[model samples]
Target chain A: MELWYTEKQTEYFGITAKIKETLVAEKTEFQDLAIIDTVEFGRMLVLDGMVMTTVKDEFVYHEMVAHPALYTHPNPKKVLVVGGGDGGVIREIMKHPEVEKAVLVDIDGKVIEYSKKFLPEIACELDNPRVEVIVNDGYMHIHDHKNEYDVIMVDSTEPVGPAVELFTKGFYQGIYDALKDDGIFVAQTDNPWFKADLIRNVNRDVREIFPVVRVYWANIPTYPSGLWTFTIGSKKYDPLAVDESTIPEINTKYYSPRIHKAAFALPKFVEELCK
Target chain B: MELWYTEKQTEYFGITAKIKETLVAEKTEFQDLAIIDTVEFGRMLVLDGMVMTTVKDEFVYHEMVAHPALYTHPNPKKVLVVGGGDGGVIREIMKHPEVEKAVLVDIDGKVIEYSKKFLPEIACELDNPRVEVIVNDGYMHIHDHKNEYDVIMVDSTEPVGPAVELFTKGFYQGIYDALKDDGIFVAQTDNPWFKADLIRNVNRDVREIFPVVRVYWANIPTYPSGLWTFTIGSKKYDPLAVDESTIPEINTKYYSPRIHKAAFALPKFVEELCK
Candidate 1:
């Protein structure tokens, strides 16, 4: 018997990858999630019929989102990652020697548990002593924690669904308050091509709270807008004004200190939105 | 009657876009091409059933290919464009006041004529008195003419089909011989994510012929790899070292002199390819 799995891009479009066998599939509160061993993208991980990551190209998204902001801050010790239930962000944050503690807050406990069980390569670092996993709404956690963290990262889903509040100005203000004065925050904005208007609106909203706000681009093949954008907000240092000579001595597959500085250089359409 | 069009992405994977009308569908000597007026991507122009460019986001590809190499040179007098049959390169080249003469060599004559008729906004400058149109193979022309042009731009297609020779070492050496001692040449390399192997191979080939070679990236929506890379070659000057104070006084949709300088800064993966 042929086992079929579907990866939905939208309500209208999806690609079905033929699975030889189902490694794991569990019905979470959110939706049907699964991990299937595949030939092309290596071990394929999916949540709510949406693709989270494939082993072949997960480094592009995970490294790009984690390394730039983490390496930019003068001293990043206590870090908070919101909604990255897959633990990819936690894996990347461990590379920084200065990070003494990392707090991960996600609304869904099942996603985290499932990822730990099936996607061991990505979730391997979650069991480290420095990581603290909290099952709660990220918005409420940020509102309650005041001036507590040196860096905050939001790795939520798309803005249209459960991730809607993450894009609001109120949530950004909460994030601003959660960080120390010199703290930096980074979040996955969206695809710039199909969702330029959405990206523009979010930039306008985030720029209102942070003194230094910039957007960067990366390529993730599974994403709807193949050209993905990430927005960075800082209270002290500008993301573009990074010191090239002082990059951290860490082994990375996708990002370096030079790229951390170059990522903020936006194209004309994106630059117009920031202005 | 409703006209229905379906594009199959993978086996048994397809999305049907509502097409109001089909504009152009013909089998050229090179490839099968079609232009369909669609809903989401505007007038979608497809080459070999693959989406090439749309009216909505063609500026990202055009402005990126033209401005970076042009603005980096202190004074570019004569320019040569290879494989930009759409005339978008010529349109951007005419913006520089120092450019006295421009030559456009495209192997396909039908694409040029069709573009002039359909894409008037982009192809308007092709009729300029300073511009010369040559409908011959670009490889032969560059071989015959050595040290005649100050700037050479290769705006060809991907490496798979008719543009296979453009990515070879011999073509790069021919391009090196065709330029003046201080001249600079730029070509669109493959995508960074899916085409890293091709990019590395081409980078190795170009490194043999040019003293200073750099790989820069841009986010183009329609390309196979949304993370697009451009390979630059120069004889005397480094592409990264630019005079930022001297901003160009030109009205552009996508590129500025400030961006021209910034495009040379590469991510770690790209920089590692150079080494």
Candidate 2:
């Protein structure tokens, strides 16, 4: 007998993985979640039939989502992660000694509970002394807060279901108000292959609210398209102006000083989306 | 009812696309060749059940392979492409006005015959007056010529079956000898995800033979991994030293003057492969 899991990226295309056995499967309050062992990717996490992250390549996504925005800010002491229930982003964010406090907010507590049991390597940092885990809607959290965080990271899922509000212009405006004067924020802007219009719209929306806006990219194979993009909006600091001297030596597998600047150099087709 | 085509990248992982219909399926003397109508990727050419190229994303691969080498050299007049049966590389090569002639040598003539009929968008330039189409062994052709070409592009299949010899160090040495003193050559090095050793070995082998050797990247969705790497070996001109003003205004969906330099700036894990 054989078992396989597949996610249809589009109506006509999808990716599949042979599963060794199911670790956990649940109907969470917000979405369906599962963790299964795989032959190639070790253990894998899936939400709403979409592959969220894999043990083999989670470092790529976590490092990319956290490091670019963290390094871009000169003094990012207070940090907040919206809708990152797995705590992967917080783990990467806590690496910087400059970060005095880190807060994570997700609407679903089941994702956090299951991840701690199944994906310990990624979820261990959620219980750190400097970190705060809040089981509440990230949208309302951003709406209520004002000039609270120095660096804000949106490690949310795609624009679907409850997360649709995160991709809108008003959410970006709320995030703009939630950051300090010199604050910087980054959001996973999705792929430009099938979601070209989504990327273009998000980039344009952020550009209107922030003085400095940049679109960078990272490659995470489990995503809808392996070519993943991220958009950074800053009040004063430019991500491209991040000096080499200020880049601290952190333990990472994918993000580096040279790659920090290189990620912004989009291909011609992807460059067209930013325009 | 629905029909789908799947390629197992490894024992546990694969990518699939819905098949509209099979255009052509045959067992040629060299390998299995098939053309299928895909719902999302348009027409796709598959060899041995592995996708070689697709009409939708072929521009990314063909443009990435030809433009970097073409733009690096101050003057690229004589060019040779070995094992590019589909003539996609030749089409891109002929775009350069400096090029006086281009030669395409592939072992399988059936591929050219089928490509001309089924993939006209990619293979139309094979009949151009400036192109010399030869049905012969690429390895032998390289060995027969010594310092005869200004630029050589090895658009060959992966290191499997008859294409195994193309990835050997001896074949790279043959390419070095076949080029003029200031010659430049580029070859598809595959993806670092499943072929890290191949990329590392190719980089090491080419670095020993050429003074200016660099590894670059492109994003092609249907390939084994979305992230693909290409290596260039030059005698006099370095790909990194390409100036902005010298880059011609070419019609490409992926390549650009900024991308020409950015492609060489790989991710940290990919950069570790080159080391």
Candidate 3:
């Protein structure tokens, strides 16, 4: 018998991968979560029938989400990652030596717990002393803080269920209040192929609150379209203005000094979606 | 009473789309051909169970394959599209007023005939006076020509049955010999997700023959991984040195002056694949 897992990428389309075995599949408090050891992508994390991360390609998404904004800021001492229960983003954040404190607030503790078990390589850094893991609401944390963090990263799921509130204009305003005057923030804005309006609206809202706003891209094959976009909103620092000499030697499989600038250059259709 | 079309993107992964109707399915002289009208990706052309192009995202592939080479050359008067039977490359190549003539040489006459019937939008320009369509093998065509064309594009399918020679080192050298002293050539190098070694080897082989060789990316969701790359080999012109001012205004839905430069910027991991 063949064991396969399929995600409905759209109402009429799906991507399927042959799996070796199912390690875990359960209904978490907030969403359905599954961890599977697959043949193509290795250990896979799925939430609500959607691919959250895969072991092979997690480095691309994690590094891209952390590095550009982290490097753009003159200093990122205090970092906050909202909804990164998988700990991939936290792992990347801990790599920055200047980051004195890294806080991760996730609504679902099961995501954090299971990731640490199934995806140890990605979740290993969550145990670091420099990192703080909280089982709480990310929006409330942002709303409660004022000028607290140097860089705020939203590593949330698609704008649905608990994550729906995270994409609103009010949440962005809260993020503005949560960051220092020169703070920078970046969020995965989903694929331009399926979520064009999401990216456009987020870019518009972030641009309204931040002095410098840019949209970039990376290729994560397990994502909806393999073309993923990230919108970076900065209070003062511009990601494009990063000094090449200042880019640190981080342990990365994807992100680099040259890639930092290139990520902002979107395809013509994607650039038009920004409008 | 449901119908679905599945393309096995890899040995363990397949992307499936719900078919509203099957436009055409036949065993052609060269390969098995199917034109599917799906609810997700609209009209999709599949050859031997591999997606060649779709009505929805073909622009990304066709535009990326054509514009980068055209913009790099100071003047592209004569262009040769080897194996672009669908005529999408010819359509894009004709957008340049500087291109006096564009020739499309494809071995499969059935592909051209079926494309003209089913993929009218892509095959529309195949009948243009400035365009010449030849039903012949691309490998032999390149071997017969010497120092003739200004630009040559290999818009062939994957390195499989009929197209196996298109990816060989001898074929690349044949392309170098077929071009004028300062001509440019590019071929679709597949995606790095499943074909990392293919991209690395192609870049290495092309670099040995061409003075300037670069690999760039574009996202077409219907493709294997959505992250499709193209390897460009140039004799004298560097795609990076293209002056922004001289880029003529073209009517394009996906290609533009800004994207002409941006497409060359690959993610670090993708860049490493070329090395």
Candidate 4:
């Protein structure tokens, strides 16, 4: 028998991967989580029938989510990540030497548990001394913490179920409140092809709350459209204004000094959507 | 009954689209051709079980192929398109007022016929007075015509069946012989995630024949990985040095003066592949 994993990105379109074996499939407290070994992408983490991360392509998402914000801020010490249970974002956050403490708030602890067992490389940083893993509602966590973090990243799944509130204007307001005076925050907006309105709305909402709001793009094959977008909201610094020559070389697969600015150069339609 | 069309991009992964109806499914003399009306992507042209173009996202691929090389050349008068039977590239080529004539050679006549019937917008320019449509082998056409075109665009499917010869090192040499001394050419190289070797090999092979070779990228959701790459080879002009201010704003959805330069800013891994 052949086992295949399919993500129904939309009603009309989907992507499928051939699975070598199913390691774990269970109903977590928040959503259905699974760890599957695949033929092409190695181990893959699936949440609520959506691909969260895969061993082969996790570097792109992890590097892109953490580095842009960390690099743009002059001195980032306290960082926060919301809804990133797989610990990929946390792994990336540790790459910044200036970071003193990083707090992660994820509603689903099962995701973290399974990731540490299956995706060992991504979850490796979660157990470090400088990291705090909190299993709680990320929405309420942002509501409670005020002016504490220097940088915040929303490494979330699609805006569905528990993540629905994460896409609202109130959430943007909460994230703004949770950051310091010159704080920067980035969120993974959906693809422009099927979720143009979502990207437009997120950009508009983030723009209303932050002085500098920009949308950047990266290609992640396991994602919905493979063209994933990130919306960065900054209080003071501009990402494009950063000097590429000043950036130090780090171990990364996707995000580089050149890509930092190049990612901001959106296609005409995507630029129109952001506007 | 529920119907779905899946393009097995590789042995381990594929993308599936919900089909509204099958407009046409038959074997042309060259290959098996199908025109599928997809619920998500509108009308799609598929040859040899691979997607060539879709009405919804055709502009991204077509615009990226024609505009970059045309704008790089100061005043392109004669342009040649190989294997773009849907006429989408020709339609974009006509947008440049400097172009006096454009010739398109395709091996499969059924693609042109059915695209005219179903994808009328894409096939609109095939009948233009300045355009010549020939149903013949594109490889042989390039071999016969030496130093004839100011710019040549290879608008082809995946390197399979008739397109097999299009990706060879010999074909690059033939394309070099077919272009003027100051000519520029661009071809749709496959994605980096699944076909990195192909991009590397094409870049290496093209660099041997041309003075300057560059690899650029675009987001095309209906394609295999949603990330598509284009390889540009030039004899004299460098695409990177083209003054962005001089490139007039033609009507385009994806390509722009900003994108022309940004597209060449490849990701670190992709840049390494080119090197």
* Top of the candidates by DockQ: 4
Q: lDDT per model, in order?
A: 0.79, 0.90, 0.90, 0.92
What is the TM-score (0 to 1) of chain A in model 2?
0.98
What is the i-RMS of every prediction?
Answer: 3.9, 1.1, 1.4, 0.9
Docking class of 2: medium
* Candidate 3 lDDT over residue span A143-244, tens digit each: 888999999999999988779999999999999999999898998899888788898899899888888889998888889888899998888999988886
Between candidates 1 and 4, the one scoring higher on lDDT is: 4
B86-137 in candidate 3: lDDT tens per residue? 8899989888889999989999998999999999999999999999899999
| Candidate with better lDDT, 1 vs 3 | 3
DockQ of 4: 0.83
- The best candidate in terms of lDDT: 4
TM-score versus the correct structure, for each prediction = 0.91, 0.98, 0.98, 0.99
Please give the range of 10 consecutive residues that has the lowest summed lDDT in model 2 chain A. Answer: A242-251
- Tens digits of lDDT, candidate 4, A166-189: 999999999999999999999999
B86-136 per-residue lDDT for model 1 (tens digits):
888898889888899999999888878888888777788999999999998
- List the candidate 3 regions with Cα displacement exceeding 4 Å: none
Regions of model 2 farther than 4 Å from truth: none
> Which pairs clash in model 3?
none
| DockQ-superior candidate, 1 or 4 | 4
lDDT of 2 by residue, A195-255 (tens): 9999999989999999999999887877866889999999999989988666866789888
Give the clashing pairs for model 2: none
Candidate 2: interface RMSD equals 1.1
Which model is ahead, 1 or 3, in terms of TM-score? 3
